[model samples]
Target: MLYSDSNSLVSFNPDTHTITVIRNNIRYDFEIDSTITQQELFLRGMYESRGYELSPIAKLDSILHINVIPFSSDTEFVSLKLDSLNNELDKFPKTHRKTTNMIPSKNYILGFVDGESLQVYYNFPLSIFMKKAWNNILTICIITLLFIFLMFCIVYLFKFMRNLSQYQEDTMNKIVHNWKTPLSSIKTMVELLQKKSISPTDEKGIEKTKFILEEVAHIQTGSQQIMRALIDAIHIQIDRNEFDLKKELITLIKEEKTAHSNQTISLDLQYLLPTTTIYASQFHLICAIRNLIDNAIKYGKDAPQITIICYQDKNNLMIEVKDDGPGIPKEKQKLIFNKYYQVVDKNSGQTRKGFGLGLNYVYNVIKLHNGRITINSTPGNGCTFTIKLKKWRTK
Candidate 1:
């Protein structure tokens, strides 16, 4: 094989156990091919035969190359390029770093020759230990980075859960406090009316009494709203009565559509609900769907079109409500479902109130069903809310 550099030309034959060393018109014939069988034998023969007393192996088994060049007269007789000896040695099966316990070095090349019947070894003063050290350092760095990233995620998750638990507790306390005032007012009014007997024909007196009674009834309604809100928040399912969900949805849809024919919201059902009944509370599901439909009507900017779709795909049964509304802003969508929060007009900014419990109730209902609800909307475009429930089978 021919090996070349800017200053030298060298040739070696693996078929014959010989290497011609020539550089600057000088030549030397070397026959060091047969000393490869024994482990220490090669090192001894290399030092003795070539008079190149290079260490067989250094501290930490680091191999050093000894370059041998031949010369004769001022002009030189045979040229010795002293080609790198480790380049070819690397490709050999038994000469790798693990087997030799001697790492390769930089600024050095290794060459090995294999005859048809024997092998030859040549060495030069050069060191590959830097490569091995850098590889080990790189591996350590990667492992350290991975460990740090995992630790960060674990810490973040712990803090998030702790904060969420605190928030839920605060919400529960507020609900209970709001619930007591209306209930107390209702109780006081009822007690006072029971103690006094007033004639029904006392017109003026009866009118005043009716007004008081109406105020008391309004308080009762407010209290019921609070109680229902709390229940919806806590239980998710407003009713525990067993009913076939498909039949219930169909019935409720027909009634609602008939009652609100003026709205002209279209029903587009493509369902594959099993004939077998599901273990679900129908009242909560109805409430959830009704709330979604109401929101669609309230927010839709154009023709107030709504489409209700139900179908199953893969592992989930999906209910999708779509509307061409002045869709909610992405930033405000999450807060819109919070209790006592509502979207108001931009011009007048008038606040329309319904206790702000509708969406929250819907959220709880979906949660009780172990279903996921997602809203997709774009401002001035449209909105779609999809509910996904885990597929189940019942006999």
Candidate 2:
């Protein structure tokens, strides 16, 4: 009593007096009669009592290979050659567009059935059973593909990281070799200087001593550069203490002026806040400020016009370092703060000297102090690095 729209082995012809069944292109007809049997009525009553309703979409793939015993017969079994019929069909598609799975699957329970169960089992087509069950086949396909792609990406990333680690180790080895020679020379010079005390009044000895001291200064500068690079490469730990922020900025400006005496430097300092005392690591904060100013000097073409703006906003102290220089490109702006990332100059096509860790160090130091730094720069307009810190109370 089931009807589906698609391909089916058995279908009905429009006739009230007869029932038509088609199997393998052959048709058979049976006359409808109102004959009643006591056992049939009993079985039908039991079937209806169980509330058994078969869906139209649920077609029988076929009966199982094993026999279905009828309660009416003691020695006879009704069987279907479903396994042999399935073997003659094409292989099941891995991800079939035409999704139809076998029904009563291999695990379906076998038992004796009444007349009603046998009628439907023999009449229904096996192909129709899978209509509803395989509906989500497309979704399954997409999810499976996505899972495979994710696994591929994870494997590629792991390989890349391993290669990067090896490269870093090799680079460090060469740097250490270069570092060891200069340190050895400095050590030897100090030993010799200690052994031979130059006479107090010898003019030639004094000039030689001055030359030795200048050479020692060069060695010290080299050592400092190496130390600074290492410091930037590691994590920053800040020791908090209260310090006058205004005083430190003045000292920073003066030191920059003294260091670059030949160049004309103009720093516009604006302090809008009446109170400047804040609790934080004074050394790292000043160093961060200095790095901003140093970057301004290093990248600026003309006499650098720098401005330091300090003010209070809500419960936070804000400092803005502005410079008149060739500004960063929109794309490279964020990348400038990444450790060991350097921006190649468009004009020179060469990156400026020193480890590219300066700005990265500045960012980490500010972050460690529970502060943040941001930048606003464009191709020709210059850069402004803004720092925000939570202003702690002195009292």
Candidate 3:
């Protein structure tokens, strides 16, 4: 005969009068009466096994009732016992014998026949199986709640990133639109002044005014390029054309020198190639270069010296911008190109003042042109930024 619980299997052999139970990869055998019914095999095996112990009714303050009949055919040979109720065995009533039916007013009864054909009964106030089922239900509910919370966090993060991207695009639009009118007025004023007749001493003033106008023009061009780039989002669209790289570098250097005339900064250009022509987005490339130069001016030491070198190496054109500035630390070099990542001032223990978007923009522009940029610097020394691009030819 075989019987099963939620976690264990019990087998009983009437010829051998032995019971075997297997649970959690372990097996146990018990000796009992051959006449024990299959319905009571689990109870009989558990009671007879040395390792198995019965628990009292938890709801009834650890109370349990037991009744034993020495002979199945004779009710006269009976004995009774109560656990955790403080009553003598002899004083137990014979009329209160163990029955198969459980009474709601009394306790639940579980009975099994022993080896000598004796009936054993145990009364419990609650079922242990129901307690295990309730615990499993609670565990499932807790796991479900945790899954819901994680999904909500993921959704919220996605929406937050989308909103932030939209806000950035709107802000760029406003800035580009607002700067155009003033830049146009400055250009017109400079043109009008150049038309006026001036003495030889005022020639220097006219030249300075022209330089300021040129710088303002560069700013206007850069602003328009950035607006277009923002509209595309992530991928910058470039308008490629063949242009002289050497001429562009010279023009940018002159503009920076004029803009920061009061500062004792020197700008030098080195050309190692005979021709510096390339097919690229001239406006965006100029903006990227200007950002590097502006960063050097803002962060470099007193009377900073900046060098712009261009050369052709086989199939690639290389340009390097070197600055004699307070060098960047090794740890921060990789992170400097990330959007919104700023350098912290070691002396003041505060973040350096800037939007932290210049290097990110430069990186994107270079990527769109199928080029690469690298930084080489160490603390207390100078920094160098190298850009390599494929040389262009008429096809």
Q: How does each model score on lDDT? A: 0.55, 0.61, 0.66
lDDT of 2 by residue, 39-85 (tens): 33223322232235422112122112112222111221122222222
Q: Which stretches of candidate 1 lie over 4 Å from their true place?
A: 1-242, 274-276, 301-303, 345-350
The candidate maximizing TM-score is 2
Tens-place lDDT per residue, model 3, 1-395, is 34343566666777788888777668877777767654355555544442455432211111121121211211221233333342323312244555455332332222431221223243433444345467887888999999999899999977776566456544653653357546655666676676675444787987888798889878876875676466445544555689987898897787677556557989999989777777887767876887789888988877999998988888787889999888889989999989878887668565565667788988987897889999999877788999888745554
Off by over 4 Å in 2: 1-224
Candidate 2 similarity to native, TM-score? 0.45
Show model 3 residue runs off by greater than 4 Å.
1-235, 349-351
**Highest lDDT scorer:** 3
Candidate 3 global lDDT: 0.66
TM-score of each: 0.40, 0.45, 0.44
Better candidate by lDDT, 1 or 2: 2
Task: Report per-prediction Cα RMSD to one decimal.
Answer: 15.7, 16.5, 18.0
